[model samples]
Target chain A: MKLKCIVIDDDIHAINGIKSYLNTLSNISLYKAYTDPLQALTDITGGANVDVIFMDVDMPMISGIELSKAIRHKTSKLIFTTSHSKYAYEAFEMNASAYLLKPYTFARFAETLNRLFPQSPSLPNISIQQEEDYFFVRNKNEKNSLIKVRYSDIVAVESLQNYVRIYTTNETIVTYIALSEIKIILQDYPNFAQAHRSFIIAKNHIEKVEGNTLKMVNNLTVNVGNSYREGIQEYIKEKTIRTSRS
Target chain B: MINIKKSPPFIRIQNWLAYKKFHIIIWLVFMLYESVIVGLFSGQFGNLINYILFYSLNISMFYVHTHIILESGLKRKNQIWWKLPVLLSLELLVYLMIYIGFDYLITDILKYFRPRKIGMTMQYILGPVYRAIYFMFFSTGYYFLLKFLSERKKTEELEHQRLNNMIQIARSENAFLKAQIQPHLLFNTLDFIYQNARDHSPIAAETILSLSEMMRYSVDSNKDKDFISLGEEINQVENLVNLHQLRKHHQLQIRFWYDDDIKKVEIIPLILITLVENIFKHGNLLSQSHPAEIKLYLQNNDLIIETSNQIAKVKEKPGFNSGIKNITKRLAYAYGDQSTFESGTTEDNYYKVRVTIKVKHTID
Candidate 1:
């Protein structure tokens, strides 16, 4: 389904900037852009069935926070595009799907979109083959070479656009395979778990769990998404040390 | 003008005494002298009671006239001139009547104890009335003298405060004047560049726009306000990061993360920006192995900010770490002992700054 998105920002320039960026994405369409928060609030409440919203935090009459509260139930996903880091906590409180700081690059914007619509149409050509405790992924650099990656040697899988960077014990390989495809191939492996929207990690490779971040054996720190946190916790629950006072 | 209510009782009493000490000392000395004279002249201990009654009445009348009557008159000094003589005459007549009534009552009571030597005559009544008039004149003079002296002291205090305020303003203005020129020039130049580059290069225009935004924030945010929304400061930090990234051609790896609910938090402006700027100024951000990281999160009620960067092998320019010093000073001024700021080079040679501010009361 084409994602119906709206942009609400006080700055016309910012709205235009976001519009230009939205033009490049094929799966998402900009439904409307509002410079006035009250008008946006009105339209949102007036039965505009929006799937996603890109909102600015600092608005004149009604803040993005208040507007989000007003239309939160109507929208499927809420993304906050702000210039300040201070609003991250507030955006989180509002259960924002993604937070993009101002002056963000196209790559960062694409990353947020991927997280919101992970199963979009562009991700169709991701194919993987598994054989006896190992997987073969088509390497993008070497057009026809299929790289062999052992399940035991895999440390993490980082998603970059339509490609996945497979970090192994011996070498790092960039393969032209989607993270979702890799997930399907490794679904039956009890040790491999999705740590973030853009990351898949081996449960045993995690050296330490520090707050929302997972420190891996090779010093790769992967963030744990709010949605995927439960699965990671449950995967490590049995292995966690417990002590009781007698 | 003075906040008497906020002062403790002891201090209030001391202030009262400081203003009225002269009048009180004079009254006490006169009372003592009068008692001695009356005892010596009368040569009879029985007359001491009359003197005591007369002195007590006189002192009480002086207090009532000076503190109540004169105080009110001085408070409305502009209007009191027209009513002064009439008010004084009415007060004197009341005093005379009170004295006469008290003298008759005291004499009648004394007759029960001793023989009455003094008789109820016109001379006797007139003499006390005359003495009451004289005491009124004396007390009124003392009251005016106190008013004049206190008024002078008040003016001197006001002048002192005004001078102190002027000096403070001058110091700030001096600092403002020193810092204003470069940013104004730089902002105009950036605007010119933005206008020129808009049609040719959108990226250059965007970079200039971001630079001007950062410059505007740095100039305007700290003008009169000590605190700004955390969101505003973060925006400037983003601009700083963006500008640096563009300068380095996207070679540097930088990551900024914060807790999701921290937008409503207030902090002294430019604090986080200063820390981030320090990284660009002194740290080796070009090394992708150790990407510069900035993280802001909440632990309980405290807002914690941590920034880490790898120490550069080659120093571009010598820095005394004045940015960190300024941040510490500002935090100390705003939060006092409620905030903690610590910065040092870690064991891995990474320069790190950790700031934890107690925000339980500040956050809504």
Candidate 2:
């Protein structure tokens, strides 16, 4: 079962960052979003379908904690996404599924998602072992070390020299694997998309769309290449339309 | 927690007994003097008048003598041997004149009174002269004895104070030595863990666990004293050495030795560790082509630790810095006159340091 999530925050960049990262995790399906917590509360309480809400603690009309408590009778799971560790204890008290600290990497994002959606017997332990859906790879320099990166943990792949540097939530692992091979392997995953020739960003990680360009959760801008711009635009417009319909 | 009322009974009883004896003797002598003087000076009206004058003279003399003695900073022997002779001679001359004048008055005013019958007048000259000498000796002796007892008491108090000061200094030094050891141990162990952590070696987690264990042991065990048993301290050092030895490709040659008996004895905690650190700090800078030798040994109830490394040859020679001088100061403070430290370059281009500290049996 997928986690039906929503982004309720005032800061566009933060909301975008969370949206981009959530795109990479197939299990975390974004349902509805609102810039204002009051409006988001009205929509959620007024019969919106949301299982888990990724709420920001700092909001203008109502705080994420306050909104979560207000909608406690409605939603099942509430995950707090903020930059402060001070609110972590408070978030847990509110029965939050997870508290995602800001400036988090893709690996940390995946780890949080794995906790939110617990594994059943049928779903193999892809975190501990590589399944047919994903594969773990690292550079020759990191292969023998403890710095190995799994495909599920890779937020983006950047082509550098004869190596493709795989950026994870924890650290980056650069390997001699061809970018074509990465693109081919990750093509089937809903979260992975070749936004540019040099970059294959996790589609779930798309934070904002300005015309043809896409900003990632890390505030890094990836050009929506002429070929992939149409597909990227369609995916974002469809998400907005679906949320409005819901 | 502190039992203040538990002072030994013997000390309290001794103090009370001494105080009672001192006051009792003073009161007895005062009463005896008053009785003897009152009897000798009361006979007739003429005698009574004469007695009043004699009594006044004695009182004046007593006041003057006591004032001089109490205010004088002179030693008891000087007051007895010199001041008494001068003061008595001066008082005697005045008394002699008074006596001669009184004799003339008795002869002129009392013509009916026989010279033989005037016993009070006859006894005045001889009695006063003899009494004057006797009183001076008595007072001076008493004053000197009290001064001697007070001086002895003060000397004992000062000795006790000196011993207490020494103990406080030893305790503080022990504390400083402990601080020095713990920080240095922490630095080296953290550095070892960091080396593994930076490489992202799978063993980094194990190194962290080992590092935590070492830290827990250091904080828990080294709370009381600056030094631990030689065997225990060496084990900590060995753990650090083993970390480097595990990465043997560095080809670092480390030799450690200590007497089997010395293992039970305790030495300053960080002394040997500092020597090891200095060896690594200097040896790592040396040409890798040349082998480094660090030798630590115990002999003759003294910790003899030495580390030698080939100096990195460069035209711009570095001067002596604070780290070595600091160790020297710490050693001096820890052992005082009981430690010897030497550092220099050998003719064979090897820089060496030799530190020797006498082992002390620490009370567990």
Candidate 3:
């Protein structure tokens, strides 16, 4: 399902900025944009229910904090779009889905959407494949030698420009292969999933998942990229042993 | 924080006996000399009970004479000269009466010893008077010592307070000078310029944005905040790098490497930023193969921030204003012996600066 969102910012340019970013994301669409916060507050409090409400912190008549307090239950997610990180705590207090810092790229916008509503429709084509259980890659660290990498042994793969560093439980092996090429090679295994633009993690190796960071069993942290949050979120939701409650 | 020097003569007079081991020992030694040593030479062994009873009366008179009579008489400074003599006379008369009463009870009433002459004669009064004067003289000296000690302590406390006041004045003066210009106005004005130039001159606007970010960090982070997560400083460092790259037409070769765990490690502000700025100022940034590298990592319990760069054309001590000296001083002030800062050139012409701050976080 496409996420219907509302934008309430005093600055017209800021609203337009959000508008341009929303245009790039296929899964999220802006239903309304309010340059006047008072009108937005009246409309939202009256009876407007949307998937997300993108609010600004510093406004003229009323702040995003005060407005969000009045109509928090109207939206499924409240993503605070602000110029400063000072109001991050306030946004968190209001149970905001994500804190989207201003001057953000299109990828950051998509990341927030994918993280908040992972099951939303129109995400970029992400097809999972399966083939082999193991492969050998040229280890750049050990004199460009071929190293046996069992699918079960892989913890995380990090993209470093043209090289991808594969971290396992015992040691790290740097290979002179692009991350995309490694993604294709590891696609045969169902456990390997891309968490960020530069990171592909083994789902079974995730010791803990806190916010947008994954704690791997090998004692490494991987930051989930904005555009790649859906796959990781889906995997986390499936693996999580939840109590029988909504 | 406020170190006040206090030497309370009677540390606590309410429970004075507990702390007065010196007073108790001196009294014990003097009593031993009078009763045991002098009694041995005289060869007239008195009854043990008589000695004990009479000595207890003398000890009581000693404290009552100084602490009570002397303290009350000298409390009024203007009348102290005459009041002290009157109090001393009253005290002497009271002591002689109590001594006679005790002697009568021990010798005549209880029949512990044979009765002496019961008349108030010169010999009877003279012995008691002499003993009273001796103890009164010693108590007066002890009283004066307490007053002297307390006064000296007051003087020291006043001196310490004055020194602290001078330091406070100096600090506020520095603060007043630094805070003359408001950060809010500076940021808003830059924001205004950035807004005006964005459409026509995008490059200038981008530079302004980066400059404003660094300015905000320096202005805001330095004020009230002593330590911040590496994440905040990393953002500003990236801004600085972007600004330099734009100025040099993207030819500045620099790579900033830091793990997510390293980002959460708290450190004193401006150290990382200053080191980065120093690299840009003195290091050769155009070499593709020898690109400048800044790495932040946690090696066990130590947080290591290392920067290595090639030497520039004219590296005259590689600094931005006060340079690494200010960083060293700040780190010393905050982390003290738990931090180490080293900066110098390697033999192969590469300048490297490594700073390690010892923190309790051991996130590998």
Candidate 4:
């Protein structure tokens, strides 16, 4: 028997990312997806049952924290997905089964799912490419010399003083590589843009842009620097056209 | 009552001696001296020795009397007019009693030493009479000088107390006014932007513009001690609420009513802001089916602001981390007992607050 799963998130990019990661596992079946919590509540109370729910913390009409509480009496397992890492502790407080941060990788997603369902199907091997469309991350301790990542799967690359935090659809990888290096490597991607001094965000994940700051679908926002605003604006314009076509 | 843990033995004794009236030691000393030594003395000692003993006892009595009667334990105004003269006169009267007492001894001794001396009886009779007159003159002079000293001490204490009270009043008023004005304006601007985000993305931009304007003015004006018009405060509120109403998708209606007369009244820069901040922090209009209502006006020199809203029932304690409480403390400090503030939650979960302050212009 397959383990059925549901995702409740208002952000389209986050929902799609989760969907893409789910394709790797054979036994886990995607049951339903909800953007509006009110509609999702109706669907749940009206008899849509699932093994686990991947919930977001922040949303427009109804907050993820409130929704989790409202549905806690009915279900036992809830996996929280969020862009803001601040919500990770809050998820555990809500008694969630797992927490998946935004722009997470397939291997991290597989680990979380494996913990929940012991007999789950094995994920396929993912290879990294080294072209402008791909990025290489070297982990010294691991047997693998260079891990390849697809540019499209990346949501943002956050700078942490000495290192950069690369966020993909399913995994978050912290590399010793500088943000400037990563920015140069992924600069050609239509969705890639540097929104803050410490942040390079994927244009596709942007839900709302206010003033010089842009709020991503992962419920995270990055500021567009005065110096880099012109470049980001062009990237956002181009991505908007591409997304609209898709 | 008293905090015994903090009080030391010496302090307790000093406090008791200074404050407690009609100390038993003073009366006991008078009674014991008269009963024991005066009754027992037969004038065996010379006249100089007798005067020395009498003056020494009086000096000790005067020291205790000066500390108790003149120096008040309260550290404020004190009077010892009646005590100084009364204590001095009593000393002189004791001196006269002892002088007369010496006559009994002198007469007996004269019988032995100057049996044949002429007019001894006349000398004995005049001796006490002269001493009594001398004591009265000196007591009266000392009485006036002590009175002058005690009066000076009292005035100095009064001046110190008055200065301390004035400084406290000024500090509290300044704090209260800052509490009232700062946070209210801040949250109102926040509400405006939040509401604007609901209507149009561009409205959020506009909200930011207004917020920046308010913030810039606040930063500048906070540096100055000048009073601002109540009318200007109301105008700022109008702009904020109007902007908020635009962004609210739910038909959350906000009704505002205020006294036009108060518009001209000059108020401490931030008094109205505290109430507004309270309203916005607790008010949740998104979930409510009906619109929230707010009313503002001045009645009997007090600013009365009333606002009502139906918000989601928050499960946790709505804990007071806000600056409103500081403002309340400040208002009371600034206005003394002249201002009144009342707040409580209703059965419908609608929180209401009424704050009244007695308006008065600065004299200088």
Candidate 5:
């Protein structure tokens, strides 16, 4: 059964943004969206059984923390989506399931959902745009000749000073292109993600995620930066097998 | 000047009234003391009319001797030695004639005994002569005292004004120094860390290097130079973006798009950096669907730096981009009719900034 969700944010833009995020997920569906906190409070308290509630911390009428307290039992899980990191402690005290900081990526949103619902099925192949599965880059070893690099074959891309090393499943390509420029090229691809300050890993090639380190397919280990730990953990959990007994 | 004008008018008027009262009371007490002291010595009391009549003539002579005659005569620098003594002797002679006639009128005509009879006798003339000289001596001292007091006040005012001007000059000089000291210290500390971290922690070293470059650019640009190569500002903007991306682990959804050829165009500095800073401050760059954009290009030889991002839901302090207002004024001063700066919230709730500088056609 798809988990029912409600988004309550004072900004219409934020509510619509949450709506778009909900549209991309397969296991969670939006029941309603609210721009008015007072109306949400009055309606939710009247006894609507919601599976999840995504609320903004800062609202005009009442804070999401205060509103969450009143309707704590109405939903099984509550998540706070705000730009303020200061309210993380308050969210903890309110027993929120998760706190998604505003300006959070779709990957972050999907990751938060997967953590709260570990038993939920994996997300479908959601692509916002249809682009080529591979692109050509001038490999330095080939003497300025362009070689095709598939998106799926990339295990990780590591920055070594001024050059970038692309670790593919078949061959390693060292390009003269800076990692910053390579990042812009891979920005549209969901599989390639920045895991550390100098490393971008393909989410599908991970063999194991032990602590802050990820073991890739080729016995290649990638250390996760502290700030990027959440994104890495979410991807691992999304693929983790959990039974009803657990 | 400031100190002199600080006192209220009402307080000054009260001081003037107090000064006038002090002078009147001193004169009245002196006249009574003279009458009482003389009567005690002689063992006989004089009538009130006689005391009033004599003291009035003496007071009149006291003021006239200094106020009118001495004031004008002493003001003459070259002839004062002869002019002052001659004027004083004439005043005394006129005083003695009046004293003799007044004594005759009182003692002979009215049968009143004179204090000192001035009937062509040496003893009587000597008493009146001594009285006139006593007042004249005091009036001359009073005139010199007034001159000394006024001179001190003039010098005091000049000193105060000079000190105020010096303080103003010091503040203006320190304003330039204040801008450099903090940034100079900050970049030096960053450079120290950059040296130590280069071997072991390349990421930390890279971050520090970018931070130092931006700091150095900011300090150098604040020198108020009229024009600078756009290449330097573009390099600093890239450094700022790289620094932020490092902090965010390369997750910030910001695009810095420009061609290498466009970087050669010369333009003013700080305008592009400030607008980019506002984007990081107030833009929501997390959405892959709505990425924040910073586009720089040349169209029709007009250099345009355009930036736009979706407005964040978080409420910051209002009028946050007041730096944009400063850019408007700076562009107006430098380019006059050749520049146009427009920045505001778009209808789609995106904060956008576009600065276009029209360049004249020139041979490459």
Candidate 6:
């Protein structure tokens, strides 16, 4: 099914720019565009089945942050577009799916969409490895060679276009597999988490948490994406050692 | 000069009498005392009437000398040296003749009424002359006293008016400075243009957006406000770096690292941005191997920012150092002795600046 999206910005030119970009993509359909934020709020609150929303931070009558909070429960994905990067923190606080800076290229826009709705219907061959501690995938470099990746030995999975680079404890494997397929197959595992747009990390491998970055056991520093920060923060809070002065 | 026409006659009279009331009261008391003393010495109640008459005559002579002679003579330039003395003596001689005629007239009238011989001795004429001179000296002192006091009052009034004018000028200047164009309107208009250009020309749209962001930061940060959140300043710094990168056609290498939790910390605005702006102006950011780097973090309740860039071989503009000077001045003003700011060139020709500010918890 094509994702249903709406664009709301006080600037008509900005709405048209986003509309033009969305028109080029086949998987997402632009249902509506709004220049008046109050009308958009009324429509969304009146039970519009919108799958995603592209909102501007600064708007007349109501701020984008305030509107996001008011209608957050009605939509599944929320993406904030703003000229100022300072709103990134507030966007994260509102649990937005992505924060795109103004004048972003089409590629950057597609990257955020892919991360939000990875497992589309076009990729129907993905399947979860149930009742097992390991999965097998074919390597891209050496055809016909199948590699066994133990769930416990997996440190992280990084996406590079159509290929997935699996970092294991002893060696690395480059497989001819989509990141969405791997993400679907590993959906049942609670220990692995998507940390960034191009990265999925194992919770046990996180050695240190510093600001918006995480250091893994293999000394790889992965930046935490704005949308996934809250979950990572909750995980860190649970494991952090609390100290008090006597 | 006094603007006598501005005050009404009644108010002027009230003011004059109020000013001279002390002297008038003192003169009346002295005359009454002299009358009683003379009456007691002569053992005659009739001496009281004589003392009253004498004092009244003396007051008339004093007014004639001061108002008619001194004023009319001193007002003219050539009459002040010689003509003034001649005018004063002639007026005094006329006053003496009138006094002698009045005294003889009074003695003759009394002798006719009582049918008794009244003594006309040399003592009577000389006593009246001596008293007349004494009263003239008193009038001269009083005239100079009034002149000195009025001049001081005029100067005091002028000084008060000048101070009031200065305060009015300062207030208007402050209002003029605060009346700059609102930043929100400028940014909104720029955003409209950016949207229109993005479809056909993405690069142009990006440039407009970046320029608008930089302009918004510089204009919207109210200089009068004391503190701003660090997160907002960081965003502006990033926009500055992006704009400079576009200026060099994406060849400039820059890296910025900031602690996410420090977003809420309040700081004196524009200090970090100024240091980064200086790097773009004078530092060699084109070096791929050694990119200009900015790092901000908190260390033990202090907000610390460090920036380092390679020094360019080209000579900088004469006023390029003013950015750093302004930052130091602002830091000193806000933090006083609590903040530390240092900048120097390393042996490897890398320009570096480090600033550490003591953060207070009360700022929200």
> Mind giving the per-residue lDDT tens digits that candidate 6 earns over B1-364?
1112222244443455467784465557566655566568767555444555667788777777667766777788976999788986786677667776656666776432322333456765566567666766766755665566678889899898899889999898877555443343455567677777765655467678668756756665566878888988887886676566545544565656665567788998888888888888888877655768777878899999999999889986677778888988889999998899999999999999999999875334
- Say which candidate scores most in lDDT: 3
TM-score of 1: 0.42
lDDT, candidate 4, A1-246, per-residue tens:
767787898766567667766775666778899988878777776665677788876677887777877776555478877544332345355567777644344546777887887765444433334456666786322433677667887888776322455667776565545565576576566568777655788878778878766876655556565557898887667656454454
* Candidate 2 per-residue C-alpha lDDT over A1-246 given as tens digits, one digit per residue, 9 for 90 to 100: 767778886766556656665665556667877898888888888876567787777578776767877887677667776644332335345457777544343445566666666561112112433256446564445433445455666677765322465766565565644566566567567778777656788877777878766776655556555566667777787787454454
Real contacts recovered, all predictions: 0.00, 0.00, 0.00, 0.00, 0.00, 0.19
DockQ of 3: 0.03
Q: Provide the RMSD of all predictions against the true structure, rounded to 1 decimal.
A: 16.3, 22.6, 19.5, 23.9, 21.8, 15.8
What's the TM-score of chain A alone for every prediction? 0.49, 0.49, 0.51, 0.48, 0.55, 0.51
Q: After superposition, how far is residue B324 of candidate 5 from its true place, in Å?
A: 3.5
- lDDT of model 3 at residue B233? 85
Clashing pairs in 2: A20-A204, A20-A205, A20-A206, A21-A205, A23-A204, A24-A204, A105-A169, A106-A169, A107-A169, A191-A203
DockQ class, candidate 5: incorrect
Each candidate's number of clashing pairs is 10, 10, 3, 12, 0, 0
What overall lDDT, based on C-alpha atoms, would model 2 receive against the true structure? 0.60
Candidate 6 CAPRI grade: incorrect
DockQ each: 0.03, 0.01, 0.03, 0.01, 0.01, 0.12
Residues A1-246, candidate 1: write the lDDT tens digits. Answer: 778989998877777777766776677789999999999888889876788899987688987788888888878989887655332335355467778655555546777888887888323232445448776776655653887789999999876434567878776676645577688788889899998766899999999989889988878787786668899988778899778866
Candidate 6 scores an iRMS of: 8.9
| Global Cα lDDT for candidate 5 | 0.74
lDDT of each: 0.73, 0.60, 0.75, 0.59, 0.74, 0.73
Comparing 1 and 4 by DockQ, which wins?
1
Residues B1-364, model 3: lDDT tens digits: 1011212245443234446776666566667667665567776667877777778878888889879999999899999999989989999999999888878887777777543565688977897898898778767766787787789889999999999999999999988655534553464456556555655665576687778777656654546776787888888887888787657645566767665556778888889988998898888987755778887877778999999999887847734548788999999999999999998889878989999999744222
Looking at candidate 1 chain A, the ten consecutive residues that score lowest on lDDT are: A121-130
